[model samples]
Target: MATTTLGVKLDDPTRERLKAAAQSIDRTPHWLIKQAIFNYLEKLESGATLLELDGSAARDNEDRGELAEDAGLQCFLDFAESIQPQSVLRAAITSAYRRPEQEVVPMLLEQARLTAPVAEATNKMAAAIAEKLRNQKSAGGRAGIVQGLLQEFSLSSQEGVALMCLAEALLRIPDKGTRDALIRDKISNGNWQPHLGNSPSLFVNAATWGLLLTGKLVATHNEAGLTSSLSRIIGRSGEPMIRKGVDMAMRLMGEQFVTGETIGEALANASRFEAKGFRYSYDMLGEAALTEHDAQKYLASYEQAIHSIGKASHGRGIYEGPGISIKLSALHPRYSRAQYERVMEELYPRLLSLTLLAKQYDIGLNIDAEEADRLELSLDLLERLCFEPQLTGWNGIGFVIQAYQKRCPYVIDYVIDLARRSRHRLMIRLVKGAYWDSEIKRAQVEGLEGYPVYTRKVYTDVSYIACARKLLAAPEVIYPQFATHNAHTLAAIYQIAGQNYYPGQYEFQCLHGMGEPLYEQVVGKVADGKLNRPCRVYAPVGTHETLLAYLVRRLLENGANTSFVNRIADHSISIQELVADPVSQIERMATQEGGFGLPHPRIPLPRDLYGAERANSSGIDMANEHRLGSLSSALLATAHNDWKAAPMLGCPAGA
Candidate 1:
């Protein structure tokens, strides 16, 4: 075989051992190393379950840290220094993820192999419908997008996201006078905002005024005099009657949520999904807590949800966990970096309790990613819990990585390290991210630096693929779960992951109601009569009160012009563009600093909040922080407290 002579920096003992192993194998040292890599890959694929480590094994690994480092170097040499280019590494993923005729033909033939004509006919019909939708995508643009959003009744997700984006954009206007001046100018032209009277602009403006516009529409259409007669009632959804109206509309549209009055009802619905060859990670919906009371209420809800899921989950097996995704922000009002020490102290205890409960029940409790600012704090708590002795034996704890963030790859590295240290296998759900518009607008408004995310749709896609390649290769540490609807992206992942990766090693996730056809294709039986892949449906369980905002964000994602679901049917866009090889895409997008790596956010970040400190590497005991925090002791001691019948003496005096 053709190869490059890889130089190794080794001490005498290691060098002698390598020579001895080579002699024992009756092969050159390089040849033995190459064969060992092939064996490891074979070990992963041939197994029914993915690789995992135990605490004892991990401790042994730490003892042989030098050897593990050598193994890591060996992995790098094997994967990166291949005979040909490492195509998966430098690939710039195109936004459009298109499938080819040849790829479809094999699958069609596989479908024909099925015994049932009805099933074959159904598959053909689905394929035709999917193509028709793809051909129709590009023509829609802003007007098409607006109508799509409107058709969805402007609920919490993507359809409603334009409004959130608009609201965020308006926040960038620092001066109230300037904001009012712009509004007045738009009013003169019979529009709500500048250039917002028609087509796409109208859609964006409506989205910007999302809830606000919804209230107006309620008033205009209510004719019941319920809203028209009460102007404030129509405009402010937070008002009693108006909030009721919003809930009614949400239930009518289904709001892409699966909530019920009780956890049992929701789990029953989830069971139907499980029966249909899909797994679920249920999210109990609620906004970030505004007070300690709200936090306590949410904690109770979570504690109950865990108990319910654990009871329901049986007969399936280990890691077939009753997966529930949690938002830490909802667990505490003070979940911020400025309160890092206190937040960690406060949040860890609650999370630990849940983690222990999860351990008791064999359920997966994942910490979901939220806004960019809270990323550091979330990671700290997650890592702390991951390493906690209570969780060392369990494999179900998970964390989400948002590909939209520029530092997502870096985040993945940290997770892998955390898992390795703890000797735990982690489920990493890689998502394209939800709060794109918010992140962009926040950066702009803060006037700190450039955007925290990629400006182009392709950049995020590229970043996701890059991260996926890393995770999929590290099967021992991470169980990668990619949540995407883009067929092109899925196909690229399947292709690049190589023959060693089993469909079971990683999972594909789609929104509960969305991407049905795409996932059907993914997990569907092929020519060999074997299932293609297992998939997860991210199901949100919550009431109407928690539904609206989530719905708007989902709408924003779906309604965006760059979204694959939106543009898949657009005929003007070439299949090549949709499925361009990332490697070539990177070559085309090359710059002086290499391809697509942008400068860090120029605005200062709150470093204190970050779990991973940048400098001052060595931490002595928390002496300094303790001294600084001592000032708070007196304040707490002096705080108001009312109890014991308010020290009543009036009854005694009267007697």
Candidate 2:
């Protein structure tokens, strides 16, 4: 195992406390210290700070998401929003989102009571479908796989297995070529199998069939001899044919997504969105820059996109710039916490250049949210950009924050303060996060204290509302943009805004193609004629190849059995279960040890340390030369042999 050396300077009393805490947890002081260091380093590396990732009840757990997840999501939202809402469901979301500040504590415990069983059953059903695919593959051309599973699980299982299975299948195997082969087989050859039955998606079906047909099954059964021999014979000689099949499948799969590969195509699409009530944030999709050359190329593409959007949107609301979001990771290879100062120094010019371009075009430029670890540094860059003299006048500058994170509220608080002090109204777009599975897996691999996001979907929903409340309440310092496809969440926002709502006070956002039905209702184009809030559509503009990760994330997010979209789509699931109040869910969770995610943290919140300075996130700002220099001097003094015994954060052994 690889490891880094960590040094600590603790006073006798502090060491004693560490020892006691370790003892209480039945761990060695060394173990405790290392754990603390690991967390501390992760925070620093991920751009979290003492005030950002410090001790708090909500200090852990967060999540992130993608594009082209519309068709099924649109269908589900249309049903839920139009259906006579279960009164309980309405009351639950309304009460939760619209509740007063004092009416707090206990979240989702009741919802858990009501929906936990159904959710579990739904998961079991989905898992069984996946297993059936596995079994049918093992059985080699078993004709009854899909039909048999559906009969056993029943017909309503479509929602359980639907669009989610494609992602689940893709997620099962990490190898791109193997996955491609699997997908190809499902779409083309799987269609040929009558007994294999229909799969969730053509892609998913193709993946299932590919599993059975492509690889050699591990077992040697007499029942499989003829088929197995054919498989080996074909496998050895079918390389050229297999590649052609995979390529064809991928092409067909690309049809639903991949709006256009070029900016001109994206711009044409954006014009259509503008015709609707929806505002567009055009994203040119690609990964982080592996080389400085790639970073320059990306920066140029962003500038061009901004120019086009600015030209088109110039005459609109002065405050509303054409929305164009970019990823900082895509701008630099060293966009990590470990690189810290170097990233800040390098990013400053690039961001300043981009922000300048946006300002020039009067376009809203937001930093797209990436993995949780990248957040801290991203925020640092944004904070600095907000303060930069060149773009100080532009409030169109903003970034996304995933509410699924335990640290979201704090991050919001930080931004709100930064916005206040910086003399620019920072635009805050709150999302429910997208990268849950990967984030969780990464944490486990690293053996961190807990997941960085809410494990339960409802918990993330709760966090979304809480953060929304803060943003709505502070409209002067920040503009709140709530992005979701859930009808309940949409209703909550409506109630929270009350009768005094303005279209722009707080806006709603959904992925461009997703929630088409929901947006219509929100804009009051529906027959009932209740005009909802102003909504923005989060759309990605890129070719299919570059947009694959984004598309896959959308699938994983919405396809999971526990997913809100999937649950409501399951028609057999009652409204009562779908909209169970989170407050009650927490109450039910409290009955069990380690059940409710909320922590009665033993340590004080890090924000408390900064007292009044913590307000509006000014406490976390580091642009102050005096403060930075003092800290730098201290660290430099301790440069060798612990910086010549000069102080840095924690004090000397004796103080």
Candidate 3:
């Protein structure tokens, strides 16, 4: 069997006693400890409790300093194993997969009631904090250009969609001809004239003027007269100029969203914030690998970044220093439940390598959350990584949980149990998810029974708080990382975490640029009029070329009309409405509304998408392992079956 050294920290008295005992037996402490553990495991597997053992054996074990701790450990392990997540979690996931919103919300509501029960005083306290967050604007701090722009051109308008489209696709288009066309299409289609001087943000106003000019140039490119002649000349020359201008604008957006183009640059940029008690988790920009080459390339990037980040961390430790967030998809071409065996064989080693390196520097390595389909796969990998002997004693391994999913609460249960079993404290970052739209669309398109995510935003908020409650309650096993830009969420979590706050009981998180203003108020000494809580920045580091998807998600998240950040930016929104408790809000709706606990009326089920005319084509979930297995079995069963058939020109005699 492969073996590695494991270090156990012991106090002076314990160490002295262990040495003396080893000396008495004329055996090495390592061998003695190994034998004790092996014997304990054997007894545990045999289902024998310490109480069940003979008095003499129990006394001998006590003399060797093993019975008490081992018994407790064995009991906990047996309990954890008995309720093993594989069955419980799988059943929970399957049940929630396409459950009706009315059915799912109430179930979650009950869990929330038990987990994050509403308190009148905590609500008021959270409201007060949120009011301060809204009124207390920073003085000449780093301005959030994207926030301002998003406010000026809200996603409900044509201009906002145009901006997002251009930002998502412009720079990535290589050929100038296609790039120019995309720029012209997006710029000309938007109504920029109305926004000429309406926005207070300089960036927004400037963008409007530039967009208006380009719109005019493109709109009048073939008109007749002196104006037309000037337009022709400018349009001929302006297409390339317009393309360059759009590229620069996208890069500017990238700058606002992304920390830097490289790991070193990102680290250096993080210093200023680090000085202000703002830690960071740098995520390298890239998508899921489509090929082995892409996977290796991403792996190399992670390794290089880890080395750089580790050296910069200087062993400040996981909680106090900077860390890195890694995507499982980036590490493997197929990180899904359907490819379970292949993933276990192929991807597990790469994940372990990155984690071990991160452990070498004692910095946190968080597994970034992806789509809902991969949730189980990620948990499987996380469970394996936690029990890894090489990674023993390392508390820097973390996992991000998206509270938007229906299965979030159960997933938390599984993770907490996993942490206890592995004897490692896991950092759990709870965030209101980023893939709401995609998850909704996917479920509807697949003709799934129900959406995997909440259709209404308030339900997601309630889920986040519920999950937060669960995470905060388990401080022994979990170090909760609350990531949100909503002042209401921050305040609720702050109050829920308790009034007496320490440096790291729990911490808040925000995006690199969007969160600074709000977090600046929360992070620092309480005597200095701050919340005195630590806040980490989720900073993405990459060049403009790789910033497409991340930027789009950020824009969509912040620009939505229902977003607290968006509403906070618009002073017209009252503080009371912005700070309304999600739990109470849902309850109030339930009391008054006809269709209280239901999904959004506009988002119909897949079968009812056309109202009555047609049903959406059903698609098998390729990510589901059991379904895939059944499909494979059925295909194989019919693979060799001989079939003799012919199309008859006329009806059979019976017909």
TM values, all candidates: 0.58, 0.62, 0.82
Best by lDDT: 3
> What's the lDDT for residue 16 in model 2?
93
Task: Judge candidate 2 at residue 577 and give its lDDT.
Answer: 57
Higher TM-score: candidate 1 or 2?
2
Among these predictions, the greatest TM-score belongs to 3
Across 1-655, the per-residue lDDT of candidate 1 in tens digits comes to 2334353455689878988998886666667777877888888888756556668787676658755555534534433232221112112111011112222222222321223543334334434434644544322343344344443333233334433443323334556445434432322222233324433334444543544454344434435645454555433432334333333433433444344546787788777657757777778888799899998988999999888888888734335545788889888998875566557767779888987887788777778989876775676687678878767778888899888776576677778877887898898999989987787566554432234465556556666777787788789988888899876567656655554555448888888655654676556456643236778878888765566567666656665666776555445666555544443454355444453333223423322223355521222111122222333443333333433544465477534
How do the residues 157-216 of candidate 3 rate in per-residue lDDT, one tens digit apiece?
A: 999898888888886788998987887788877889888888766777987898998887
- How far in Å is the alpha carbon of 57 misplaced in model 1? 53
lDDT of 2 by residue, 1-655 (tens): 2323333445699999987998798776767876877898998998775664455434332111112323324433332222221123222322232122112334322322324554444344333322322333221122123222222222134423332344335534557667645544443322223424454434446644654454222122223556876667554655435445544443433333344577778667666656766677778888888999989988898888888778878657424445788999888888875566567678778888988888876777888998877765676687678878887677788789997776676677678777887988887889999887786565545433345566566677777766777788788878788888766566555555565775458777777544444565565453555454677777777765576677667545544566554454344666555655555565566666454554424322223323466521213113222333345555434443322556667885766
Each prediction's Cα lDDT score? 0.59, 0.59, 0.81
CA error at residue 92 for candidate 3, angstroms: 1.8
Looking at model 2, residue 654 earns an lDDT score of 65
Stretches of candidate 1 off by over 4 Å are 1-254, 257-261, 500-504, 527-531, 569-576, 580-655
lDDT of candidate model 3 versus the reference: 0.81
C-alpha positional error of residue 569 in candidate 2 after TM-score superposition, expressed in Å: 2.4
